[model samples]
Target: MDNHDLVALSERRQHQVDGVLTAFFRESHYRAKALGTPYATLWETLERNATGGKRFRPRMVMAAYEALGGEEPERAAYVGAAFELLHTALIVHDDVIDRDFMRRGGLNVSGSYRDIATTAGIPLPVAEHRGMSVAIIAGDLALFNAYRLIDRSGVEGALRTRLHDILDEAMFVSAAGELLDVDFALRQRPPSVDEVVEMERLKTAGYSFEGPLRAGAVLALASAEAEEALAGFGRNIGIAYQIVDDLLGVFGDERDTGKTTVGDLREGKSTVLFAHAVGTPEWAEVSDWFGSPELSVEQAQRIREVLEAAGSRRFAEALARDFANRAWESLTSEALPDAVREEFRPVVASVLGRVR
Candidate 1:
């Protein structure tokens, strides 16, 4: 298909998935209402947050399915919605772990609850506790709903079993990565590049890309070679995507990225970009500022300059390009159809954009 035709296919698939999500949320709200819990607002918060995202994971599901020559767009829609729900569940939990009050420039699930408690004149500590409690429960609800959506997608028998196994493994792997992230944050020493790459594989590549692609290919009953090839493609591109994300976190305009450029610096995230500069002489210049919440704009700028001077940013860009190149090469596997290869070709450019 031509680029225009592919874009149209994406739009149609997204529209179908959005419809599924809308109906799913509506039922969830009603179910919450029946429970009559004061936490009915959780559904509303989830719905809003779910609506705000770009639906990229769901799109990946559909795209991968199409590439594999899956003829059932309706079935793809069901699986696509399931992947999106999983993403929503993870993002909610991630924000809670990060203690982030905002996402995409608006109050997150925890933030919404915190605002309610604080407005009611609750003590700061008590309000914060309440926020955490609600966010945890909300995240759990989302997590379970993801399974429910996939189970309800009607991929029966062994195929359903395979899909479930993939989803379960993805969540398990991602959790391990999150644990590593927490461990890294608490460590006195910086992470090595290898550790960073492994963490990215589990945290991002597995779920965000590989899992979705694998699940979609499974639905298409793709051959083992085809499945392996797509997994490699997703893994490489997913790492590149994470690298781009880390770059955006530190350097991109907030207006463009929809996130604070300094949040990652303040959080002391052990991203590949940061890992590349560790132990370098220039890194010593800004080591003290690495995890400080009190990190200033000037300090961040200096750190950015130091990272650049140390060639960390360039190293990260080069690494990302290498991964993107491997992803492109994976598409050359004879197991994948020409249509599938063409459909996924644009992902390379999107993954590794021009570094400023």
Candidate 2:
């Protein structure tokens, strides 16, 4: 186990993804090849967008599998790559909707096309609209490819139906949660912490933890009891993870997190800390900033101070620890297999240690 090469393992798996993407693009129609700049170019864009990142979701799957005493690392890598594809598909669609021009210091799909059109002297609005349409199609295609990859994984049988159900449910719940999140942003009053937490659980945990890791363990023939236990653990940890993500979105250094501080402020995101700040009378001024297009970074900084004064940051951090502790409890339980427990624990540490 000590000799296992994690970097080499990652590259070999990435190569597998590259080969699959290459074959898919090569079979494309002539017009698509022309527009996508040799189909390989489009795949390369997705690959580029996916670069220099933590592979947390996939690693969670592997950890759960290893905890179940499974040893098929290559097969687990395929499971992970499929998830990365799914995640990138979500990112493509999300960036288009947000009109976000850059991600990871590179032009996002819509942004690149918009730039190209504008450089060619087209009107900015026309360029952006066309670029958005193209991005939407690209995102849809990526999602379709994700499903295809999962189907071709040869992970079949009674558990196959269960996996299918899990995926379907995750999609439905996440979409509903996302819709609610959009609605919350538009509301005069932000959502309560409980409501936001529920949304985070459905939108984040289902896909990020419950479904993928369970699929990995299922692939390894893990018992139903073990799978259920993992799901419980994952759900708690995922909520904590998303809450931390909210904190990072609002407070992390852009150079470190690959995003600007208080990005949630610009969007007026209805996160837990946002709720706490607004609810406190001492920080009640925060309500005035919600949905205020006139709000500036200077004002947001001051409001974040109010949040700090209200102990929201500390509150959120404590909550994060609570959820993480719960996951640790489950991971160490007798319900989990004996041989795989120690390896799985590191995954929790990895999740908790992420800077971004």
Off by over 4 Å in 1: none
Which window of 10 residues has the lowest lDDT sum in candidate 2? 22-31
For model 1, what is the error of residue 132's alpha carbon versus the real structure, in angstroms, after optimal superposition? 1.2
Q: What would the per-residue lDDT of candidate 1 be over residues 156-236, giving only the tens digit for each residue? A: 889988888988988999999988988888887788988998898888788999988888888888999999899899998
TM-score, cand. 1: 0.96
- In model 1, residue pairs whose N, Cα or C atoms come closer than 3 Å (at least 3 residues apart or on different chains), thus clashing, are none
Q: Which lDDT tens digits does candidate 2 get at residues 236-262?
A: 878878888888887777887788775
Q: Candidate 1 lDDT (Cα, whole model)?
A: 0.86
- Per-model TM-score versus the true fold: 0.96, 0.86
Clashes of each: 0, 0
Q: List the residue pairs that clash in candidate 2.
A: none
Q: What is the lDDT of residue 5 in candidate 1?
A: 89
Give the residue spans of candidate 2 off by over 4 A. 1-43, 50-52, 290-295, 350-356
Best by lDDT: 1
